[model samples]
Target chain A: MDNIAGHKSGLSWVTNISVVVLVVLWLIPTVGLFVSSFRERDQISVSGWWQAPFSVELTYRTRGDGEVRPVDGGYVMEGNIFDTGEVRSSFEGGASTVSAFGDRGVAPAEYPAGTVAEIGDGETLQVNADGTYIYTSVEEPGNRGPRVYFEAETPPQFTLDNYRNVLTADGMDRAFINTLTVTIPATVIPILIAAFAAYALAWMDFPGRGLLIALVVGLLVVPLQLALVPMLNLHQRLGIGQSFLGIWLAHTGFGLPLAVYLLRNYMVGLPRDIIESAKVDGATDFQLFVKIILPLSFPALAAFAIFQFLWTWNDLLVAKVFLPSDDASKVMTVKIADDLLGSRGGDWGILATAAFVSIAVPLVVFFTMQRFLVRGLLAGSVK
Target chain B: MAPRAGFVSLKGFYMPVIVQGLLTIVIGVGGCIGYFYLSNLLLDKVIFPAKGENAGRNINRANQIRPWLFLFPAIFALGLYLVYPVVGSFWRSLYGRSPSDWVGFDNYVQLAASNEFQQAFFNNLLWVIVVPAMATFLGLLVAQLTDKLSWGNIAKSLIFMPMAISFVGASLIWKFVYANDADIGLINAIRASLGFGNPIDVMQIPFWNNFFLMVILIWIQTGFAMVILSAALRGIPEETIEAAILDGANPWQLFFRIKVPQIMGTIVVVWTTITILVLKVFDIVYTMTGGNFGTEILPSYMMDFMFRDDGRATAVAFIIMIVVLPVMIWNIVQARKEMR
Candidate 1:
């Protein structure tokens, strides 16, 4: 044991290291997206969120104003402090300092009070700490604005407003509802149809049953992309193009092969005796299915449901083709893909949050139903 | 217990079954007649734009025939929505656009002759060959390595988490790692740091781009392979392994002789399963590079055809079917064999 431990621990180190490396490889980009999603766009441009925890420096211009005070030291101060909202998004908080503050647009170490520096604009500006500041109109000015700079403390942090923006985008909410509308029914219908087909194939005595089962399995290998254009053309000819029914049928057709494959395999493994005993008790096929087989096949049904649901929910192409993208039927997958895939699809935060949001349902589906995948419900039933 | 009274089945469940069949037939015939009458009314009404003597009864009284009138609409919708599309696609595959001009065998001929089509065909062939084999092999290796170990379940769970991620999500995730900027795309940053000149566009290279695209599918599929193969691996008898070890067999020998042959059927299932996936790959390619710079595969090509409103789209779709049909048959054969 000692020799084995001594010899193996060193070798085990490599395995551990590699595992860690692989884990990090998978996690880094996902983490990067998460961090980038919360940060301001300019902040994202300037530095990575990983370095955000350390000291951050921000330089800006501020003016002596907004005081309106006759203090013991100053005797006179007046102005309103104003912040253009653009500055707030970039400011880093914590261990932050103003490199310069001035009425003039210059990074200077110091500026004296009552120094009315001329900014390019006709307006003159003044500022004070209590955030009261004002700008005076210059003589003979036409369409010019005030200039003020104050390097305020910026902390390394961000908010979830990007996620809010993405979720609240006009198309996204509709698409989300649209995805649910398509996916939920699509997932349900196939499972219902396939369960009956599977039960018959598994338990019923009918001619050509094996061949039909074989054909369905064969259909499994046929890619849906092969079916797509023809199907669309079919929909067009049939005069059902770009409708809810079109997408539902598309999802059902695409989901069927796997659904039948999985369900039949599971049903065939069911205890034949229970089905036969039901027959002896005069339980009709429907009764047998509803009372006994359905409950037993729950695990398999659940697994397939999760599979179908996730796939349908996450589907973009079928939704794009069959469902009209014109407001009513644009699903989440199509909408999010549009948001992220073109133009500034490079925005890490919006993509991550949206990406995370899209998978949130799938994750729930998986967690809730994963037990069915491995649980040996039919284990003792047959043997 | 309720006994069947002569010809009547107990509780008459069979009555509904018979009624359903009869109703289907009635709806089928009634639907054609209804369509004809409706068109006649349409022709008379639209060209004439005049009120008929029975128009009031025709409109309101038609609604009063039966509450089951909704049932007819359901039937009509099914015919229009489902059966009509399949028949149309099949018919369209025969003729050119507009359903009138006969272009039998020409679309197929054009596809067969073109090098682009051949390249796509061969690329799909490569994907079918390579992805399943590599993913299944890697998965089997990982599954076996992780099996019987204390932490194997955790390893499997961690590896499988990517499968939970949507393909688009995954593509976006990888995008940053492969991003073009220094702060962006991790690979290039590391490459530059390591003194490599020029960042490579992994998704854009011809011939080699398929492999880069395949990597994501492999990454997602390997976890599936592991879980399934892990189950099949566990079904292997411990005595067989132990007996092999007792002899002059080593780890590699045990793996090849004992562990592998036992799980060969399952290996085929997983391989063929992923091969099916390779045939339908669209989102990854669509997201990563939009099937450009010589990265076009069959699915993406079909999408292009679809968007362009090309006759070639249906042709490509049909071609994809031809490629996939044999593999499907093989999966069924393997499945039957596995059942036995």
Candidate 2:
């Protein structure tokens, strides 16, 4: 018994370790973007985002101002290694604090930041904390200045500049509002209409209910891409082309199958007794639905609402097809891809910030109402 | 008059586009609400006049008509937006680019003969196979692993976080990981640290880049699989596991022989649901590679032809529908069975 228990516990340890490893692996990509969004290109280029929380080593080279002049009885030229005037200029600029310096190419940080290291031939290199360095050598070091190797400790940096740039300059703010414009009505209208349909399917003794339910199920997997060109052509011919009204109706039509399916399933699960008793009490079907059914079906409605909201909000293809390609009408997903991701694909900060901005709302919705979201997923799929 | 003749006049009315948008919402939602409410009222009060002689008979007639009144708006929208377009696309597929040219099977022939179409068809096949299986497997694995731990919910939440992110957003996130700059891309950074020289642009490579794009979907979908399968895992009765343990079965044996057999239904559900998603996958390929370098899938391929070749685009759309039809029919069957 003891041997078996020991092996079982060992297996659990493996489980725990593997879960942690999997979670970290899953988080690494997003975390990389999250960190990269707060950093400058220079810092991002020099080191990994994992090193963001700690001090990073950086190297800088300053040109020599080697002018032959007499200083302390030797021909010498002196200047700060930072080239930005005083040593404090480097510190003030938020660069890594100089920790070590080197006079020779071999070891840049061989000497500490404040001390003077003497090479042969009356040449001495002195670097101070404020990045001011005095290189003393005879005969102007042959009209060439020594290349002072600078190694500094750059403190971890985090900034909101990327967010500011994305929101203001990259037009994400307008897209955010435009997305909201499409999402609200798209989400609400479908729920209202689908609720009626769902209620009818759930409770009403309709002849085609079985066939309608099956139709909804079959339509569930029909790729909206199939509907794209044809719908656009219809919209153009009907004069609703590239309009918000057009996109809303598109979202509504696409969202209805899942909405009706989920709501009808939830409504069907309502205790038969309550509905029967309500009907017997002389409450009309419409009145019972408005009062009893709608209230009781809040959780399901909420789940579907979140699903619709996230679907509409995170949607790119629907917006691409239905909404105008013009910037003024584009939603955040489309706008971000068009303005930032396309032209400045290499600008990690802009891309990360824009991507994060676009996803932030759905993330908030997903976390705050995750219970309903999961409920929706389970009911929507499994049934 | 045509059915959308009223909409034709509304579309031509002069107004700011935003006002027109708000008006549409008011008109559209208001129209649906008004239709259901007024239609019911009309049926009860005006058409049937339930309070007159033979009131009970009048009420019966109104009751019989109420469900249709409630269902009319939804049916109209679905027919106009979904049903009509489906039939229209099929019809459109028979004609050439201008829709005036009478082309019989020419579009399908072109789609079958084109090199890009063949690559897209096969690549889509690869995606449909690989994404669903791998995502479901990983999800089941995570669900099983996390179920044994105390902090499982947190782990699950973190793993599931990608679900909230859009495919475009996810593509961007993974783009950073697959970045060609050794200093920027996390994958390349790790590679460089291990002395792998300069970064290799993973997306530029043919064939393998398709898998790189598929990883984004698997990343997003695994959480969905985990959540559903986790619920299924918990649904397993305790007596089954206890009896297996009593029989001195190992953990692996307990999982495969006991747990898996019980949850096979949920596993299939997750697999097919993901398969449906895989068929419609566009944004990942659209944003990541734009169907270039042999990464083209059917949806992206269709999208490329959408602006130019209407027949070919519609033909591609039909091809996608054909691929999705079997699973869709299976889905409906399963749903009907569940309903029963």
Candidate 3:
């Protein structure tokens, strides 16, 4: 009985352990992104993402110049770098001061000018001989701001600053709009063309119908890179090259083969009886397609739409190929990637935020457009 | 009402029949063929062109034209956008130029000899082999497993959620997973916490990084496979499973002998579908690593050439096209076989 009970407990424990393990494994990076996205740069450097959101053990030293003006009667000196408002609010009222203005965090016993600072207030603080001070003020108000005394536990406060810098300060705002301009038309144009082609391919019987489709399928294997020069040439001939229209056309051209293939597969699954009956009723293919087939193929259309939208949105290569290399026409993916890798690759904060921002639109798109993708249009077709 | 009317009015019937049904069918079929062969420009001209079929049925083929008239704008657009570029890509592949400084076979030879081209080709080969196989395998596995259960819909939905994530989003998500720093990426953090060495650069791991990139494609595509395969699996009649069971066929035998054979067509379709996807596998690699660190595939390499402002990009593009063409033919043939 003891052996059996132990085995059973172990089995359950193993299952529970796996579940916990999987959940943690999944959450580790997610939790990191959430934490790193919030923490300041210096904090991020000191602790791993997991150790973040916890009170970090940090030591700070405060200093005052007190060097230039050696008013012998009083202890006043002109500081080198710090003017008024040099100390943050954390230092505004806390009992902190520069202890021996040396370079290192673990400073030597003496500064260049042999100066020291101690706790004081706005009025009646007296500096004594030998770098010491007496803060004795009658009118000192109660310390109101964050206390700056050494070793104060500053609980992690997440801020909107990262998001702000990413959205506004990073020039992502223009890139965001530019990306949408490129992606929306790029996505929409292909779906529109592909839907019609899909319908025609699935329903309409024409000569080389097999061949036309084979051609599209053939085009699929022909990597977009293969077409870059030719398309650029055509774009030049058409004079739409390096324009938004050119990029959109490039995306649409590249995107359509898959779109047509998918939508055609989906359309062929619609009830042929409905289509035949509509044709029997003197409805033209267009009328039949517009009224019946398209409505029926919505699930597939939406799925393809979402797919195209995302592909185009995230595309940098084609945008670079067809669109002008000018800043105004550059899409978000290109802008974020090029900018970061060029000037600020090491700025992980800016990079992370920009990366997230670039993908934010597509993320929203997927969540909403996903449901239509769930329904299998062909479920009842073969039966 | 028309059932009785069909036999009568022979003179009225033959003329109306010849004019309306026969002519329209002929023109529709004719136009379809015309568009198919004559490249894009001619196809567009035939469909929409400057001339409208304004004449009455007696004067012109306007009656036949009326049925396919709605196809004009779309056909024109398709011709201009998709069809034109295909021809353009092929035509442009013939010449190497910064702008019409034509070097004929030079481009092809350059492409054939290029180290970058070879790398991209091999990488593409890897993508074509690995991505489709893994996607099909996982999708089939998920579909089969989920199809057996009662609360399968929820399980399937949970699995399918990744499909809803775009390639870029998915890459971002996994970037966090593979981040070199523990705080930034999950896998590294776990490794560090488990007392492993310092964090590993998963993306920078060459050769394997291709597979690492392929994993993202697999993740996104698995949901696609599961959805399609599950639908196919569901279509298998329950009686068949019951009959196999009654015949004393074990689970494996029943699955292989009965269920598997029935859905082999769907499986082929799924495989070929994914195979086509493998040929065009660009975004995940491009987005994740910029095709650097030994990850350059055909499309990414082509993009590199274009960005370098070199004519060689076109030649590379042509080689990629040649590589993909045979597979394209195979896919079409498979699809046709399925149709038959």
Question: Which TM-score does chain B of candidate 1 obtain?
Answer: 0.72
Model 2 per-residue lDDT tens digits across residues A1-383: 21443465777789899999999999998888888889866577777777788777776666566355777767666665566433444456554457898866778788888897896787888888766767776654675676677787777777798899988787677778778878888888898899999999899986888998898888888878778888989888888777787888899999998998899999999999999999999998788888999999999999999999999999988998887776667788887666677888777788888888888889899899999999999998854
lDDT of 2 at A76: 64
Residue lDDT tens for model 3, B145-194 = 66645556656665666554445556666776677777666677789889
Candidate 3 CA-lDDT value: 0.61
List each candidate's DockQ score. Answer: 0.14, 0.45, 0.15
TM-score attained by model 3: 0.73
Model 1 error, position B121 (Å): 3.6
* Candidate 3: residue pairs that collide: A49-B183, A62-A98, A226-B317
- Chain A superposition TM-score per model: 0.77, 0.82, 0.74
Q: Model 1: per-residue lDDT, tens digit, A130-178?
A: 3445555534332333446665446666777777877776446555655
lDDT of 1 by residue, B58-129 (tens): 544432332222123323333343344444455566666545768886777877898777777777778888
In order of appearance, the predictions have TM-scores of: 0.76, 0.89, 0.73
Candidate 3 ranges beyond 4 A from true positions: A1-35, A59-61, A64-103, A106-154, A191-210, A213-221, A258-289, A376-383, B1-63, B66-87, B148-155, B164-169, B194-200, B203-206, B244-262, B287-291
Q: Of the true interface contacts, what fraction does each candidate have?
A: 0.24, 0.59, 0.26
Task: Extract clashing residue pairs from model 2.
Answer: A87-A130, A87-A131, A87-A132, A88-A130, A96-A153, A96-A154
For lDDT, the strongest prediction is 2
Give the DockQ (C-alpha) for candidate 1: 0.14
